[model samples]
Target chain A: MNNQFKKGVLDLCVLTILKKGDSYGYDVADTLSGKIQVSDGTVYPILRKLASDGLVSTYLKESQNGPPRKYYHLTDEGAKKLEADKQEWDVFTKAVREILEDEDK
Target chain B: MTKKEYLDKLTKELGSMSYNDVKDILSDIEDHFTVGISAGKTEEDIANDLGDPKALAADYKEGMDLPKILEKKTVNEKKPKAPEPTSATVCFCVLITVFVAIPAFFSLLAVVLTIVLSEIAVALGGIALLAFFWTFGPFKATGLLGGLALIALAVFGYALSYFAVKYFVLGTKWYIAFIRKTWHEGL
Candidate 1:
């Protein structure tokens, strides 16, 4: 996939994942890697974007691992935006797929 | 850099920004990290998700704009990005005159003056070279010729110094013009 296209989708993917539950940085990296072949570093910038836009809030939770882990919780605004985005993505991808498939015939 | 390290470096580099803006950027970064971690990602993995640092920085720069950055560069900030070229040239010329050129010129003149004065005191420096070979040392043609040569060299040295002062003055003028041109172009 083109890197730019992948980036455009990245923030949406991150927000969609966060819709599941509050998560720390490490755990989020692992989960996203399983679903998509992507660089692990990309998540931080997305998280930065969401937080900057007031889409999420975070707090530090004591971790058994090494340092205190920061946990991110989705704000109400984030949840509403995520819902709209997922709806749009479903229609957009399905339409694109239909067009490409019809071209094969 | 890792996610934590990236944020730290950015914070340090952007020390001049308002605390609130920095805090907002940090919180957003933390949120992204938290989301990634909850998905079971490693710190490196999470950092990778952010994409290239330079590209990200450029995006931030585009959004904030350099004018905004300069606005933040207050008078308190060290070296307030210099004034216009003409003004800068004037300042530079002034500084050079006071610190370097003036001292250099005076010292040079002093040395030349000392040589001239000493030559006058001894009287044998320049004028003695024209001495006659018919006196007590009539057979010492080589010695008399050497003395004349020495006198010629001393006079030549003093004349060279006069040109030095002239060049120094010309330099200050060029410096001022160069400064003004640079400033005008920038404006």
Candidate 2:
């Protein structure tokens, strides 16, 4: 995978995870890297940027195993942003796919 | 690398960010390690999977720098430097400084001098009255009483004068010290 393409979708991918449910950074990373070849640490900075941009808000929740864990949840604005990003990604990937698949035609 | 060593390296590479921000980042890293450990992964595997701390730090730096760039741009656009102080402005500043200082100095000097002179006059008057009562006998029988009262008044006056002089001397010393300190450092 091209690093540029991964970097480009990382934000959307992160927002997508939060769009599903409020999850901690580790779970988000796990869910994300399961499909994409993302470095485990990359998700953290993405989460931080998302939070700073008001796309997500974080809170501390006690874990059964250890101390409190930070949980990130999407805000209303974040949901809106996720929708917008989803639309943009759809259009972009569709266009790219059609162009790439043109050879089959 | 072990989780602790990896986290410490990451923290060090992050460098000089806000405490809360650094803590947040470190917690995220810790969370990753914890989840990895729970998933039966080794510390080395998790650390290796995270890639370089320096590169991770650069990603954070990029995100942090975005708003900062926009802020700097807006500030630069909004603010224009005022014209440099002209010689006329410098002259006016000096004039105002002297205008305020000269009258203030003279008034303070006049007040202190008046206090000292009045105290000296009171002392002199008390001594002269005592001497007159002792030498010339208006009432010889009451001479002792009058003399004692005058002597007490003279002592009180002298005490007041002594205090005034001491206060003036100490004030001048403090003023000199303050001025010297400010000169060496700045106002």
Which candidate wins on DockQ?
Answer: 2
| Model 2 CAPRI quality | medium
Candidate 2 residue-wise lDDT at B116: 69
**Tens-digit lDDT track of model 2 for B1-187:** 9999998988887776777878978878888888778878999999998889888887887788644633222224666654565565555555644785456556767777777677666666656666776788776547556656656776776677677668767866775575445444443
Candidate 1 C-alpha lDDT tens digits along A13-81: 888788899987656766786788765545655675677688888888887644577777899999998
Model 2 alpha-carbon drift over 4 Å, by segment: A103-105, B66-187
Cα lDDT of model 1 by residue, B70-183, tens digit: 533434667656555676556765676689867776786676667666555444654555564435475567757766776777677566656655665676577567545655
On TM-score, the leading prediction is 2
Model 1 residue runs over 4 Å out of place are B1-187
Candidate 2, residue B55: Cα displacement in angstroms equals: 1.5
Model 2 preserves the real interface contacts to a fraction of 0.71
- For candidate 2, the per-residue lDDT at A54 reads 97
DockQ of 1: 0.20
